[model samples]
Target: MTAELKLALIHSPTEPAQEAAKVLRDRYEWVPIEQATMAVALGGDGFLLQTLHGMLDRRRILPVFGMNLGTVGFLMNEWSPDLLENRIERAKTFTVTPLRMEIVTVDGESVSYPAINEVSLLRETRQTAKLEVLVNDRVVMPELVCDGVLVSTPAGSTAYNLSAQGPILPLDSALIALTPISPFRPRRWRGAILPERTRIMFRVLDPVKRPVSAVADQREVRDVATVAVAIDRASSLTLLFDPEHALDDRITMEQFAV
Candidate 1:
């Protein structure tokens, strides 16, 4: 049944992706994205995230199969122009639930963004940021002086979370990582792993002196006074991968990486 499934071909503007698109277009028939049952994305992890975010914005979720044409294609499969339909038919499927970040600025402006990977709060100036951590409306840490903090989903644990020494979580773990960027007070406190359903909050202790910015994946909001993060099960996304290189398998393998 791939023949019966309408497919949409989306590619990044990079030369390699553009060139590959030309080859795939000549070999297969593709419909508009709005009419497609599934989509094939060409590029690296960044472009793949962009495509997924686009779908979220349009409220048109589609299972996407990504082929790597950029660096660090952690979310993409090996690229090949031949037998794409067969590849898609045989591909393994993984469901990913994104995090929802709600922010309130010092000026009282509120905005929300969805992050497929992580939502990080970073110090906007040289002064260290001071934050109060809360879980389910209960204060956990009254004062945390740090460069910043981030809440990462299992899908994002291997990215910036790992870089900041946060634990890598299995894709099916149903857990989230609360990691501090560079803690100054309670220096020994590292990070925590919480149930996916938990609502995490961070309150800026000194917005006037130690301004902070919050980033939901690539989107950022400045001078945030408070931030809330939680898994948005309603906006779950699906990704397709070759059986031999499935995303869950890749995450498991990362734990053993040198």
Candidate 2:
């Protein structure tokens, strides 16, 4: 990085993050978030995701450098109080495009949202959700009886997707994981990996009896009758990481953990 590199430091509202932000502010002069070339996010993975989504919503292309201060910081780097500029200079860049979720409700309301993790459809009632899975306008599964289902990006494979028995995807893999949460029928059926560009559609079999909700990361729409999900390659978010501990390396390490 050049000496003229101006950084915008933003931290979560958590106490630890606020404290660290004070320390950073005392040592370095920061610029406004909108005017800076890059951003320094101080918090956990959740905050990082929030920052990314906010940027995506505004069509801002600011690259983020995340330093973990929260409990779970899988997407964050180890925090340092000293020589922060040098760390960013040595960091690696990783670009990821988010999924666009087009949701339609039973009332005929339609909305679209962007998700960096996975677009999931979950049952709102105690009743099991019955869904018809379609890919590229073709019926793949006529009916899937389960608690929920999700389409996960490579970067989010290890998150809620993993807990739902979804496959873990490599960072650079040009594929997405389509996994069911808990299947009442088709007990033996495992999820499939589709090409990253594939368009996935899920239709609620009985929206009135079995209410279903579609969620794009944090943005959620209730009583969704149909949802179409696809990767939005036109826009992308870039995150920075230390070369020795890049996102690809972290994802690879997750696969070996017991």
Indicate the TM-score of model 1. 0.98
Candidate 2 structure quality by residue, lDDT tens digits, 150-203:
999999999999889888999889899999989887887779999998999999
Per-residue lDDT tens digits of candidate 1, residues 1-258? 355799999999999999999999999999999899999999999999999999999999999999999999999999999888889989999999999999999999999999999999999999999999999999999999999999999999999999999999999999999999999998999989999999999999999999999999999999999999999999999999999999899999999999
Question: Where does candidate 2 stray beyond 4 Å?
Answer: 1-4
Error of 2 at 160 (Å): 0.5
Superposing all C-alpha atoms, what RMSD in Å does each candidate have to the true structure? 0.9, 1.1
Candidate 1 wrongly placed segments (more than 4 Å) = 1-3
Displacement of residue 189 (Cα, Å) in model 1 is: 0.9
Error of 1 at 104 (Å): 0.7
Which 10-residue window of candidate 1 scores lowest in summed lDDT? 1-10
